[model samples]
Target: MKLLLLLLAPAIMFASERTVTMKVSGNCGSCKKRIVKAAEAVDGVKDAAWDKKTKVFTAVFDDGKTDSASIAAAIVKVGHDVEASKAPDAAYTKLPDCCQYRDRTHD
Candidate 1:
């Protein structure tokens, strides 16, 4: 029993923490707010941060309850484009002019 408990401890700890960083298209502070809020809304997501200049979003979540894909989907739902997922056209169009990262004219 002692050996079993010790062997499972590491696995349990590993399953509790997961961090992922991926590209998220966003141009300004409002975009950053939406992206981070979307990620944090997902179950098991402990924290999320997005950098406008780098277009990178980092998320920390519990592997046992959620994965990177779920977090990405949540962000997409909020009209941000993640590396593996893109927001729907309708959703993207609803973003404010300043938050339209896909529009090169604004850049």
Candidate 2:
């Protein structure tokens, strides 16, 4: 019984469902695809979606391997606006002229 329970413990401890939402600014299907794809690209991200106009992004992933802020950062990496998160200089600089957030603070 002890051996059997020990084997099952790891699987039970590993079971988890992590989902979160974020704010991002945009206005088109192309933007949606880009933002969602960025978030989903992270390891352990099971899914991602966004409303381009509202900038709300939803993501489902495994918490043991990932977290919300990192996911949000990834979306910003591909040239989308995350509400309170800033994209890295290299990532932000790569944005299309129009996609750029135009905020000095983001630097």
Candidate No. with top TM-score = 1
Query: For model 1, what is the alpha-carbon lDDT of residue 67?
Result: 96
Candidate 2 wrong stretches, greater than 4 Å: 1-8, 11-14, 101-107
lDDT of 2 by residue, 1-107 (tens): 99999998987798687999878866566667778788889998998888655567899998877888889878877876688866677876776655555542121
Give me the displacement of residue 10 in model 1, in angstroms: 12
Ten consecutive residues with minimal summed lDDT in candidate 2?
Answer: 98-107
Model 2: lDDT of residue 18? 92
Question: lDDT by residue for model 1 over 1-107, one digit each (tens)?
Answer: 99999998987877878899999998888888898988998999999999877888899999988999999999998888888888999999999999887865244
What does the lDDT read for residue 10 in candidate 1?
89
Report the lDDT of model 1 for residue 4.
100
Per-candidate alpha-carbon RMSD to the true structure: 3.6, 4.7
* Candidate 2 local Cα displacement, residue 85, angstroms: 1.2
Clashes of each: 0, 1
